[model samples]
Structure formats: C-alpha cells, structure tokens
Target: MKIAMWSGPRNLSTAMMYAFGNRADFAAWDEPFYAAYLKRTGIDHPMRDEIIAQHDADSVSVSAQIAGPVPDGKEHWYMKHMGIHMEDTPLDWAEDCVNVHLIRHPARVIASYAAKRENPSFWDIGFQQQLEIFERFPGPVIDSADIRRDPEGMLRKLCIAIGLEFDPAMLSWQAGPRDFDGVWAAHWYGSVHKSTGFAGAEGALPELQDEAAKLVAQAMPFYAKLAESKLA
Candidate 1:
C-alpha cells in the first residue's frame, strides 16, 4: 500500500511516521518534496539555512533520494508530508495512493511555529491552502489530534478508508528510526528519533503572545469548520 500522510509542522507528524514505520513489513519516506521545492524555487524555508548549514545538503534532493526506490521488503509504504509542502508539487504524484490529510488547531500550531527561532509560519496562508485542497480531494481525510487520541480505532478507520483491513501492528511501534524515516530524522526530527511510542501527551503549547493568540483565533474558525466537515 502506498499511503501518504499530509500534515503541518510541529503537529506530531514525525511521531506519527515513527508509529507506522514500526511495522516490519512497511517502508516509509519523510518529506521528500522539501529539497526539490527549495532547489527549484530558490526560496528558503524557515530552517532551510540552518539545516543546510549543518547537513550541507538540500532538503529537496535528500527527500527525492529517500523516496526514490522502495526496497524489496514491506507490503505497506507510508509517506509523511507537510501539507504546506504541497503548494508547489504535482498532485498526480499522489495519484493511486491514499491521501490522509492531517490537521491541528491553529492556536497550537501558531504557538509551535513561533517557538522555533526561524520561519514564522505563514499559518493563515498554509491553512487556507490546505483547506481548499482537502475540499478538492476525493479520498479519505483525518485530523492528527484525533488520531493521537484513538490510535487503534483511528487506524482501523484509516485502513477501511483505503480498502484494507486493520492490522494489529499499526497501534504501536518499536523505538528508534526506520530506514524510511532516515531523511527526515537526519534533517527535521531529533526528539522523535528517540521516542519509543506515541508521545501521547496533549496540552497547551507555550503561552502565546496576545498578538499571536488573536491571529490564531482569527484562523481557528476556518480550521474548525474544515475539520468538522471532513472528520464528520
């Protein structure tokens, strides 16, 4: 199975990938389009410069290499992507694959985005764009927060959406990174690499500034409505 999960940053997206990669039979890839997008656009991402400074590789090139070929093993392949990354890529690349759209509350997302020194997110921009894409997609969609809350139930539902039966293996994963997750781990995720299972913790992120709070509130209605409609 070729499964693609699209999500925003700081939304436990990396953790989710870790869960899926635990399946011994599955191969996964993390955020392949990032490097190619940066290479083609000459636009720098928030962490692009810093990450490149250390890794000395473009994220797009690395994503492509990781995504390039699936090994002979694994019945299922999962791809974890940031929804905002879809802005410039070909939609058909995901054709014939299950598109799992993941979302998080704008308030929390904004808070997370702000905590990172680089790349103040274009939250409104990214959110609105993803909302439109979700509306257009004909496949199954889901909320990341909901998945964390009910791993087994949600995995079953996700399997059903893609015409597969639930496998007990989806519920939990062994600690550490898998081959499919290498590109992402090497780049964007350090904390996730050390995790043994779902982080499972949910709460307010760092306190938001009044200005950031208001910005998130303004975008909340749109995200809430979108999630309500898709998840309903």
Candidate 2:
C-alpha cells in the first residue's frame, strides 16, 4: 500500500513521518515535491539552491516517482507531503495512492509558522490548499492536536482507515536522522531529530500579530470543514 500523508508545515508532519519510518514494512519519504515547489515558485527558502539541485524539479517526474514502486521492496510506502507543493502540479497521478490529510488549528499553525518564516500567509500555512486537495480527492483527515493528545489511538485509527495493521513500533523511534531525510533536513528537522515519538500537546495558543491573525481567520473555515471529518 502507498499512502500520501499530506500536511502543512509546523503541523507534526515530521513526527508522523518518523512514526511510519519506524515501521519495518514501510518506506518513508519526506516532502518529495519540495524541490519542485521551490523551483516553480523561486521561493528563497533555506538551502534553496542546494535543494533545487539535489531533487528532481519536474512535477511530472516527481508525481510519477511518488506513484511508483516502493523503495527496497518495502510492503508499504508512506509519503510525507506538503499540500502547497501541489499548488501548480497535477493531481490525477495521486489518485492511485491512499491520501491522508493532516490538519492543525489555524491559530497554532500561523503562530508556529511565523517563528520560522516571519511572514506566513494563508498559502504558507496551507489550509486553503489542503482543503482544495481534500475536496478534489476525498480522504481521511487527522488533526495534529488529536494525534498529539492520543498518539497510539490516533495512529491505530489511521492504520485501520488505510487498511494497514497497527504496529507498536510507530510509538517510538531512535532519536536521530535517517538516510531518507531530504537535504533541507538540517534546517527544518532539528526538533524532529531530537524527538523519539509524538510529543505532548503544546501550551496555550500563541498570540499573533494583527496581520497574521487575519490570515488565521481566513483559514479557519477551511480547517473547520476538514476538522469535521477528522478521526475521533
């Protein structure tokens, strides 16, 4: 089985990737289309040049690769994807995979993203884009908060939804990096590298500036729509 677990940044996506990576039957991929997104938008993200040079920048090639066979003949393939990465890419290719949407509250997402990018907008947080993909290709939606609150329960539900057996190995992993991590891991994966499993819930919601708050407000409806369908 091939699973496309789509999520926005700062949404426990890396932790989820770690969970799946710990499974012996699964081959995990981290943001396979990130380089293509950077190439298409010319966004000056950290390690931009190296990222673009390191990964395939053609959307068609990337999509084909994502739908291709599992690496090393693993039984399951778990792909960690950013919804915004599909901004200009085609979606039909992904229909073959079991898609899972991971969501987080907009206010928390905005605050967390701002710390990294300083000026995150709706697109940066990916709520609208996530909604679009969810609509185009309906799938299971899991909230980051829900996962953090009950890691095992949520993961079990996710596994059942995707027709995979739940493995206790998904609960913890060695604290470090893996060979499959993207080159950009140095910049974005510090917290995840230090984590062995899903961390506890964060503190109170962060206070956002007026502009950032407005962006969150704009994203809340979409988040709400998806949240309504999230696993209990």
For each candidate, what is the lDDT? 0.65, 0.89
For candidate 1, the 10 contiguous residues with the lowest summed lDDT are 51-60
Clashes of each: 4, 0
- Top TM-score model: 2
The TM-score measured for candidate 1 stands at: 0.79
Name the runs in model 2 displaced over 4 angstroms: none
Q: Write out the backbone clash pairs for model 2.
A: none
lDDT of 1 by residue, 69-171 (tens): 6655767778876666566565655665677777778767777666653435455235766666666664666666777777777777877877876767766
The runs of at least 3 residues in candidate 1 whose Cα sits more than 4 Å from the true structure, single-residue gaps closed, are 46-70, 123-125, 182-187, 204-207, 230-232
Write one digit per residue (lDDT tens) for candidate 2, span 93-139: 77899999999998898887777777886778888888888988788
